[model samples]
Target: NLGSPDERPALYRERSPVEHAANLDCPLLVVHGVNDRRVPVGQARLYRDRLRGLGYEAGEDGDFEYVELGAEGHASSDIDQKIRLFRVLGDFLDRRLG
Candidate 1:
C-alpha cells in the first residue's frame, strides 16, 4: 500500500490507485475494513466517490464495487472473518472473470 498522502505528497499521489482511477478500463472491487487503522475506511470511500464523480457506476455488476467489513482491522486474526473476506474476494474474482 502507498504511504499516507499527507506524509509523502508526491509519492503518494504517484502510487495512489485513486489517482489512476480514470485509466481503469475493467471492473474494480474494493474491500476495506471499517476498523483499519493503517488505512482508514475513508480512503476507500474517497476513491469510490471520486470514481463515481468520474462517471463510474457502482454495483455488484457495475464498473466498481465496494465492501466494508465491520469489526475488522487492516487484517483479521479471526478465522471466521478471514474466511468470509476470502469468500467475498473469490466471488468478486469469479464475477469479474466469468
Candidate 2:
C-alpha cells in the first residue's frame, strides 16, 4: 500500500494528478462516488477545480467531464448505476475518439 501522505509527502505529491494538471494534453473524464471512503469526494472536486484553473473547461464539449454518483461508493454495484456509468464513459470516449 502507498505510505501515509503525511509521512511521504513528496511521493504523494508526485503521484497526485492534480499536482500535474499543467501536463494534461487530452480530454479527461473524472467519475467519482460521493460516498467513497477510500478516496474522498473532495479529491475529485480539487482535481476538477485544478483543471479549471489551468483553463480546462468541464462539460460534454469541453476539455473534461466530472461526474459524481450520489449513492455510490468506491465501486458501484447497482445495475442501473453501472449502466449509467458505462454510458457516461462511452459518451465521453465517443466524443473524444469517435
| TM-score per candidate, chains pooled | 0.87, 0.95
Per-residue lDDT tens digits of candidate 1, residues 1-98? 66566878999788788899899798888999999999999999999998999999999888988899999999999999999999999999999898
Runs off by more than 4 Å, candidate 2? none
Would you list the C-alpha lDDT of every candidate in the order shown? 0.91, 0.93
Highest-scoring model, TM-score: 2
Highest lDDT: give the candidate number: 2
Please list the residue runs of candidate 1 whose C-alpha ends up more than 4 Å from where it truly belongs after superposition: 1-7
- Superposed on all Cα atoms, the candidates' RMSDs to the truth, in angstroms, are 2.3, 0.9
Summarize candidate 2's per-residue lDDT along 1-98 as a digit string, tens digits. 88799999999999999999989888899999999999999999999999999899989999889999888999988999999999989999999999
Cα lDDT, model 1, residue 59: 92
Residue 98 of candidate 2: its Cα lDDT? Answer: 93
**In angstroms, how far off is 52's CA in candidate 2?**
0.5
